[model samples]
Target: MLSQFKTPLLLLSSLALCACSAVTQLSSTQSDATITIKEGKHSGNPRSETLKTTSFGNYEFKVEQPQGKVLYGVLPLKFNGGYLAADILFFAPAAFFNLREVYPYYEFDTEKGVVRYKNKPQDSWLEYAPLAAESERAKAYFNAKP
Candidate 1:
C-alpha cells in the first residue's frame, strides 16, 4: 500500500528534478578555434554540440588560437525555465542560491595581447555575451551566413 507507492513516488520525483535542464550548442567560424577539457577530450571548436546536464554547473575549457595563444575561460550554460521552476517549487531552500550564472566570461584584448576573463570592454564582441537580443542576433547572423 503506502510502502509500495513510496518507491515509485521517489523515482518520479528524481526524474522530475533531473529533467529541469535543457540542451544548447554554440559554434564559432574561426577555423583555428579549438576546445580541450581537463579529461583530455579534444573537440574542434564548439560546432553542433548537444550539451545536456541535470545540475547547474560550469566546466573549464581552453580555446586555442591559430597563433598558439591559449585562452582559458568558462562557457556559461544557464539554467532553463524548467530548472528554475523546479527549484522554486520543490527545492525552495536551494532556490536561495543563484544558479543562473555558473561561470565567468572571457574577452580578448588585442592591445595587451591577452585574453581576459575579468576586464571587459564597453562594447564586447563575444558571441554569447548574455544579452538576449545580442545572442539572438548572433544566432541569426551566423545562420544566415554561408
Candidate 2:
C-alpha cells in the first residue's frame, strides 16, 4: 500500500516539473536550432497596451511559459523581432535583476492596460538602444511548416 502511494506522488512531482517552462536562450552549439526570435512580424500577434512605434523595437513580448496565468516575466522583442530582453540580460532570468523600472510582472493582454504585477507565467518589455544582436544561427529555431 505504501509503495503504491509513493509511485503516485513521484509521478505527480515529475509532471509538475515538466509543466514549468524553461526560459533559456541559444548557445552557439544549439544556436541554429532555437529560433524563438526572428525578423519582422511574420505570424506572431505582437501587441502593446500603451504604445507602438513605426518600428518593431518599441515592442516587447510577455512570454508565459505556463499557459494558465498572468505573465510572470517580461521579454523584450526589438526591431526585426530580435529578442531585446535576452539581448539586454543575455538570458539572465529577471528574478536575479530585481528591476523595478522593468516591472518584473505584467499583463498586457488584460482588459485593464496596467494592473498590479503578479507571477503568473510570463511577461516581457521593450526599450530603445544598442540591443542584443540575433545569433548567427538564429534562423534555425523556427517551427518551419512552410
Candidate 3:
C-alpha cells in the first residue's frame, strides 16, 4: 500500500525542489531606456526576470539609453536557507543550487548613467568608470548632430 505511493511522492518532491527561482524587478526614470542581460539565460528588458536559482554564477546586465550610453552591472547568485533546508529534507540534488539575492526593485538613472537599488544608497552595482568616457562621448556626439 505505502509502496504504491512512494514513487509518485518522490517524483513530486523532486519536481518541486528543482523549481527554485528568483524574481528581479527593473525600472528606469527614462521610459525609453533599455535593459539587457548580457550573460546567463536572461535576455530582453530587465523589467522583470525569473532567474533559475539552480544555475549559480554572475548575471551581467546592461542599461542602454537612447543616446547610446550604456551602464553595465552584475547580479551575483546568493544562497537561500529556505531552499537549502527544503533540499536537505526532500531532494538532495537541489542542495547544490544557488539563489539570486536581488533587490526588490532597480531604478536606472539615464542622465547620470547609474543604476540604483531600493534602500541601498551608497552601494551601486554598476561599473561606472570604464563606461563614463564612452557615455560622455556619445552624449557629445548626439548633441552635436542637432
Candidate 4:
C-alpha cells in the first residue's frame, strides 16, 4: 500500500517544485521613476516580475527618476510561511530549499535622493544616510559633464 502511493506523491512534489516561482508586484510613489534590475532571476515588466522562490541572491535594482536622480537598492525577499509549513508537512527535503516571498513595496527618500530597502528578510527597512564623500560621488555621477 505504501509503495502504491509513492509514485503519486513524487509526481505531486515535482509539480509543486516546477510551479514554485512567485509573482511579485513592484511599486513606487514616483510614477516617472525608471526601474532597472541590475541582478537576480526574474521575468516580466519592471513593475512586476515572476521571481524564483528557491533562488538565493540579492536582486539589485536602480530607480532613476525623471529628473535624473538615481537611487540603487536591493529588492527584499522573505521566506513564505505557508510554503514552509506545506514543505514541512509533506516533503522534508523541500524545506531545505530557500523559498522566498517578495514584498511589493519599494520605499524611496526623494529628499535624501536615496532608495531605502531592507538589508535582510527579517530586518526593518533600511534608511539611507550618505556620508559627505558618498554624497559628492553621487552628485558627480549624476551631474558629470558629457
Task: Candidate 2: list runs displaced more than 4 Å.
Answer: 3-11, 14-42, 46-135, 139-146
Q: lDDT by residue for model 3 over 1-146, one digit each (tens)?
A: 99999998998776675555556677766777777653334334546776666545554556677798766655434456766676677767866665345554567665775666653445645423325554454445434543
Cα error, residue 93 of model 1, in Å, equals 7.6
RMSD of each: 12.2, 16.5, 8.2, 7.3
| Segments in model 4 whose C-alpha atoms lie over 4 Å from true places | 1-19, 38-46, 107-146
Report lDDT per candidate: 0.45, 0.28, 0.59, 0.58
User: What TM value does model 4 have?
Assistant: 0.54
Top candidate (TM-score): 3
Error of 1 at 75 (Å): 1.4
- Candidates arranged by lDDT, highest first: 3, 4, 1, 2
Task: Look at candidate 1 and give me any clashing residue pairs.
Answer: none
Least accurate 10 contiguous residues by lDDT in model 2: 26-35
TM-score of each: 0.43, 0.22, 0.58, 0.54
Report the lDDT of model 2 for residue 14: 65
Q: Which residue window of length 10 is worst by lDDT in model 3? A: 37-46
User: Which residues of candidate 1, in runs, are more than 4 Å off?
Assistant: 1-21, 37-42, 52-56, 79-81, 91-146
TM-score of 1: 0.43
